[model samples]
Target: MTGRIVRWGAVLGLGSVWWWAVLRLVLAPDAGALEGAVAAGGWGLSLLPVHCAPKSRAGARGVARWRHAWRSAATKASPRPRSDGGSGPS
Candidate 1:
């Protein structure tokens, strides 16, 4: 829930940067403005990972959680096996 909110927040932040740069570029009509717009556009595109691949990110998080839960359960099921396969610690 919070993650989705944070993701959207990031999008809006970057989008604002992109739009501002474009507006400046359009209004200023100077050579330097082009460079700034290009740079800001790059920054804006950096947000695409969150916007474009939401499912993949969510799946990765789920996989991470599942792995953690599995590890904890395995450890709790029994004494962890010794590297040498002994019945008990030396």
Candidate 2:
């Protein structure tokens, strides 16, 4: 369960970074920030490099980093998962 949480967290974090990069791109901002995020994410992702099983230390580290990154992007303001199932009733 913990691992699952981390997995989703990392993906969301990376997605957030990508979204920010897109915004920057649209604003005609400096490429530095976008480039930095890409570079850092690439490096971070590569460092541990998840596999079928996190046997190696590097893989474990990578998983941990990924989870941290994801959690950071998540709504710390509201940790609870919002129920947006639908507005209509059956």
Candidate 3:
């Protein structure tokens, strides 16, 4: 859960930076070299997660196992519904 939160945060932060850089370029046609570099860098950096994503078969299997374990743990920890659908015991 924490890993997911951090990854999503990084994606959103980098994506925002890229969008801001693009907007700057679009609004200012005469933007300088530094601005262009920032825009390019931002775009490239935003793709870092995709570039770093697991690609190997072993890596895919590891991710699947992790997901399965997490789901199993969650299922075991949650309360089950009563067959009679009562909120509480009398």
- Name the lDDT of candidate 2: 0.70
- Candidate 3: list runs displaced more than 4 Å: 44-90
Model 1 ranges with Cα > 4 A deviation: 29-40, 43-90
TM-score for each candidate, following the candidate numbering: 0.38, 0.35, 0.44
Residues 1-90, candidate 3, lDDT per residue (tens digit)?
999999999989977766777788889887777777879997676577654554574366577788999998988886877788966656
> How badly does each model clash, as a count of residue pairs?
0, 1, 0
Per-residue lDDT of model 2, residues 9-89, tens digit only = 998997777667656656655667656667566567667845566457435557778899788878466565559755567
In terms of lDDT, model 3 sits at: 0.78
**Cα shift from native, residue 46, model 3 (Å):** 7.5
Instruction: Tell me the tens digit of each residue's lDDT in model 1 across 9-80.
Output: 998997776776766667776638565867676776677755455667656557778899999898887676
lDDT at residue 68 of model 2 (Cα atoms): 92
Give per-residue lDDT, candidate 2, residue 89. 71
Q: Candidate 2 regions off by >4 Å?
A: 31-33, 36-90
